[model samples]
Target: MNYDIFNGDADGIIALLQLRLANPINGELVTGVKRDIQLLEQVQVRPEDRLTVLDISMEKNSAALINALDVGADVFYADHHRCGDITQHQNLQAHIDLDANTCTALIIDQLLEGQFHLWAITAAYGDNLIAKADELATKVNLTKVQAEQLKELGTLINYNGYGSNISDLHFHPADLYRALLNYPNPFDVIIDTNSPFNLLQTAYQQDMDNALAIETKHTSACLSVFELPNTAWARRISGVYGNFLANQQTDSAHAVLTDNNDGTYTVSLRAPLDNKQGAGDVCSQFETGGGRAAAAGINALAKSDLPNFIKSVESHYLV
Candidate 1:
């Protein structure tokens, strides 16, 4: 059996698209939303079964992934997430490249020599790496208007994956993959019969409304933290909100905290421009999580620690 696991966003879907276009009839394509990054545990693989993991970090799944390798499943993994360290495996051929400034599309573009450069531009912009997207789009002879349209399409499709869970999203990341696979160009996809654009547009509207309604706790002139009463949409809204604020200015940060059902809160942090320098290691103060300069997240944090959490955020950037 041949299996392909990919993220349900534009990049993940398009990366698989490139793979499929290059090698159609590869195998079954597996996918889920952004939150379903831990997708390796669900599959049952055999020694002869082949697996291609796209846009999901193997380092995050070192154990089950290692087990799959030990089971003799030949794997091809491609990702641009926070992969700590990829272990060596006989059956694994990884295309994992973790560059904050780059993404799976760029990796594919690098390998394919601009054959898919235009789509890669859309993916990069969707991932919130606009400068890189434009740099590549420029090389591909895309007009300014075309580049902007690609960016818009990228943002909308990516927004579709926002939501604490699938309930809030227009479709499951897997379903989104199916939708995207059906259309190589998102602009075309939006106008298609089975398009998921309506769902994405609704989420975008809701995000703007909710984000605007919330008040901010100031850390500095450019930074603010907004607390959302944890709902089905909180976890998914944080990244989108962060990106939203970033576009408003070059020096803004949005730390969105959602109160989870378990009395713990899930934190999704984003730094508007210099994400690397902003919120660099603020979450680690609790010994729970950490991320790069521009973005990071914490799995869980005690609600009672709100005071300490505020203090940490204050000290890291505002202080």
Candidate 2:
């Protein structure tokens, strides 16, 4: 069997989309909600199976990776997140770049020689690599209107990945990927009236409106913290809302905390756009946290640790 495993976010979905489009394959699709990064654990690999994993952090899935290799599965892995020590294995083909400006889709773009360049650009935008996406768009001679469309499409597709589980998402990431497969180019997705883009757009707008009405739970010149209820809508919008907050106040770091039913919190941290250096480090201080410098997250943080987490961010970004 052939298996394609990835994070359910825009970068992961689009990265795999580019690969499958370039080299068509029929594989068992393995993915879950955005927070479900440990997808490799759920994949039961056979010795003869081939696996392609993308967008998820290798460090978090390191054990499963070893298991797949031990079973003699040929693995192709690519990501931009923090990966712990990688071992040399004959069956493993790993493409990992930790550059803050790079994402898995862009890495695949280079491998495919830009056959699906516009889709890669959209993934970059969805991952919030805004400046990089815009630069690529311009290089390809895309008009201003066209560039904005890609950005919005990326953002909405990305928004569809957030949620405590698949129940909160408008479309399961796999279904979204299948929907996108019908469009060979990102522009075609924008032009199709019945595409997932329209459904995602309407859903994204509704979530954003609800998010904006919530006042900040904590605020400072250097940091602004917002607490969202333990509702499905809050879980669904937390990540994108953090991106929205970061874009609004380029100089101020933002933290979006979503309450979890078990008295924990799911945290999304974005360093100030003007100084995107401390978020990943800050989140890493906690056990359940991991991510890139510009953005990072804690899967489940104890309620008591909220203050300590906030303090860490303040000490890192504030004077």
Candidate 3:
């Protein structure tokens, strides 16, 4: 069997989309909510199997990945997240870039020599690498309106990935990937009257509106924190909302904590745009937390640790 495992976010989906568009493949799609990064363990690998892993951290899936390689599976992995230590195996082909300004889709774009450059730029925007995406868009000579259109499409797609579970999302990641395969050019999705772009755009605006109305729980020169209610809307908006807050103040870090309703909270942390570092380091200090430098998250943080979480963010960015 062939397994196509990827994070459900825009970067993962678009990265895989570029590869498959270049070289068609029929593989079992394995993906879940954006926070579900330990995806490799879910698959039962065999010697004859082939696997393509994208976006999710190699560190989180190291054991499963090693097992797959040991069993003689051919694995192709690509990501921009924090990979602890890469294993050396003939069956494993890994492409990892930890640069804060780059994403998995952009890495794949280099591999494909820009066959799907526009889609890669969209993924960069969705991943919140705004300045990088803008640079790439300009290099491609995209008009201002065209650039904005792609940015909105990317943001909406990314927003759809931030739910607590598939139930909370407007479209399951696999279904979303399949839908996107129909359009080689992202602009096509935007222009199509009936596309996921339109559906997600409407949903994103509503959720973001609700988030914007909430007052900050804590704010300072170095960091700002917001607490969101335990609701589907909050879960759907938390990650993208963090990005929105980070963009608003390029020098201040932002944290969006959504009540998990189980004596815990789901935390989304973004480093200052001007200094895109330390977010993953700060979040990693707590249990159930890990991610890239610019953006990281904790799946379930104890409510009592909220103060320490804020302190961690403050200390990291303050330096």
Candidate 4:
């Protein structure tokens, strides 16, 4: 009973695809929408069955994972997320790489000696580490046009993971996987013109339209706050909007705040690119948020504290 559990995003599915292309395996794919992070628990791996976990972090499900390992199933784990120590187990072989440039597909590429480098590029691009992916793509001799195509598909797939739930996404990730299965490379997927990629691009542009309509507060010298309407497009597109606004107005710290389903607001904060002087520390002042120097995300803040949240943002990032 061989079983595969993965992230269900392009990185997750194509990470499995890379492994399969390099070394064929017989297994059942256990996957769903992106929020289904606790996927490994559902798998029934016997003592004799082999399990391969891709992209998902073990720490996110430590108790269940240790239980499975105790049951005598062999596990091959490949991921690039933040996870604790890999316990010594006769049946477990860990291929975890935490480098920010690393993705599960890139880890599989290393195991396969670049046999599926193109797919690795796509995964990396979709993860928004474009510089890292582009550097790797040059080694494989990807033309400028081909590299851009891969980047587009990568962004499209990543955007597909934005929603709080699967229904909020433009298309189900599994449905995107089926369409991708027809093409070995993204170049083939993009050139079809009538491909699902087109549908995704259209939706992405529409989201951008909604994002462009947001109004900003300019509450402080370092922080600019844009309170957004409560809509699927708003929730799905806020982070992207934050990134875009920060880039456009390079000097000011930008925060994209969206009204959450719970009547609270979700905030995305970005640090200035020049100084790497960041404000995740400030976000932690409120509930439901944590991140590092350059980028950080906050889940939900009460509407009542919206003024206080703005004041905190002002004091933290303002010059």
Candidate 5:
């Protein structure tokens, strides 16, 4: 059996989409809400099975990966997130780049010689590699209007992946990936009246409108913090909303805290756009936290530690 295990975000879904579009495959799709990164554990691999994993941190899935390898499952892994020392195994092919500017879809783009360059660019935009995506779009001579369309499509697809669970999302990541498979070109997704793009666009706007209406919980010269109620819209918009806040104030770090309803909070932190460092390191201090430097998150932070989290982020960036 062949299993495709990927993060349910725009980067992961688009990465697999480009791969399968270039070399079509029939495989079991394994994915969940964007935060659910330990997907390999769900697949009971046989010695003859093959696994394609993308856009998830190797550090978080290391044990499952070793189990698959131990069982003789050949695995191909690609990601840009923090990865500890990787295992050297004959059954594993890993493509990981920790450069803040690159994402897994772009890695696949290089491997495929840009056969699906447009989709790769969209993934870059979705992954918040805005300047990089713009550079690629310009090199390809995509018009400004076309570039904006791709950006919106990428942003909406990315926003759909932010829920705490599949139930919180408008479309399950697997369903979103399958919905997008028909459009090998990102432009086709934009042009199709009935595509997921239309639904996502509408949904994104609704959520963003609601999020924008909420006032900040804390604000200072170097940092700003906001708290969101425990609603599906809040869960769906938190990450993208952090991106929005970062863009609005490029020099200040921002935090979006969503109530998790268990006396804990789900935290999305973004370092200053001008200095994208320390976010992953700061989040990693918590048990359920980890991510890239520019963008990081904590799955469930105790409500009592909210003050400490704020102080940690402030101290890291304020100096």
Candidate 6:
């Protein structure tokens, strides 16, 4: 059987979307919330099983990957996150670029030779590589209005991936991917009145409004932090809200912490836009935390460690 395991976020979803569109596959889809990156372990790989994994950190799933390869399963992996030590196996085909400016979809774009360039651009936007996406859009001769449309669509799709779990999300990422597969061109989804974009847009605005009303928990020259309540809206809006905060102040790092209601907080950390390095490093200092350098997250952080988390962010960016 073919297994398509990917992060539920825009970069992961769109990366697989572009690949499947280029090479059709009827694979079992495995995904969860954006923070759920240890996806390879869920699949029971057998000999000859084909797996396409994207946008998830290989370090966290190394053992499972080794198991899959040992079992003679073929694995194609692509990601931009921290990959510890990659296992060299004849059964594995890995495309990993750790550059802060690139995402998995963009990597696939290069592989596909930009057949779905527009969707790749949208994924870049959704991943909050705004300046890079804009540069690509201009190179393609997209008008300002057209670029904005893609950005909005990308942002909304990204917004849908935030939740603490699939229950908090407006659409399960698998369903969203299937719905999007019908439109090879992203613009068609934007133009379609009945598309997921419309539903996500409305939901995004409402949740964002609620987030905007909350005051910052802490702010300084190097960092700013916002603590959100333990509610569906708060969980749903945390990651994108961190991106919004980062865009608002490019020189300062931003952290959006949502109460997980279990004496822990779900943390989304963004490095300063001017210096897109060290986010993953800082988050990795804690348990249940890992991601790309420009953007990283902690799935559950204890309240006691909150101060240390802030101190870590400040110390990294203060320099």
lDDT of each structure? Answer: 0.71, 0.92, 0.94, 0.74, 0.93, 0.95
lDDT of 3 by residue, 1-319 (tens): 9999999999999999999999999999999999999999999999979999999999999999999999989999999999998999999999999999999999999999999999999999999999999999999999999999999988988888888889999999999999999999999999998889888988999999999999999998899989999999999999999999999999999999999999999999999999999889899999999999999999999999998998888877786
How many angstroms is residue 285 displaced in model 3 relative to the true structure, after the best TM-score fit? Answer: 0.8
Compute the lDDT of residue 121 as modeled in candidate 2.
Answer: 99
1 versus 2: better TM-score goes to: 2
Q: Give a tens-digit lDDT track for model 1, residues 251-302.
A: 6666777778788877777765764454536765664555545666676778
Best candidate, lDDT: 6
The list of candidate 5 runs beyond 4 A from truth reads: none
Which pairs of residues collide in candidate 1?
Answer: 275-293, 275-294, 276-293, 276-294
In model 5, the worst 10-residue window by lDDT is 164-173
Per-residue lDDT value at 189 in model 2:
94
lDDT of 5 by residue, 1-319 (tens): 9999999889999999999999898999999998998898899889989999999999999999999999999999999988898978999999999888899999999999999999999999998888899999999999999999999988998999998878888898889999899998889999999889888998999999999999999998888999999999999999999988998998999999999999999999998988888888999999899999889999999999999999999889886
lDDT tens string, model 4, 64-116?
67877998888888877545677678888889876655688889988988777
Checking candidate 5 for backbone clashes, the offending pairs are none
**Model 6 / residue 224 / CA error / Å:** 0.3
Name the candidate, 1 or 5, with the larger TM-score value: 5
Candidate order by lDDT, decreasing, is 6, 3, 5, 2, 4, 1
Model 3: lowest-lDDT 10 consecutive positions: 310-319
- TM-score on alpha carbons, each prediction: 0.87, 0.98, 0.99, 0.80, 0.98, 0.99
User: lDDT of model 4 at residue 47?
Assistant: 79
How well is each residue in 94-154 modelled by candidate 6, as lDDT tens digits?
A: 9999999999999999999999999999999999999999999999999999999999989
What pairs collide in candidate 2? none
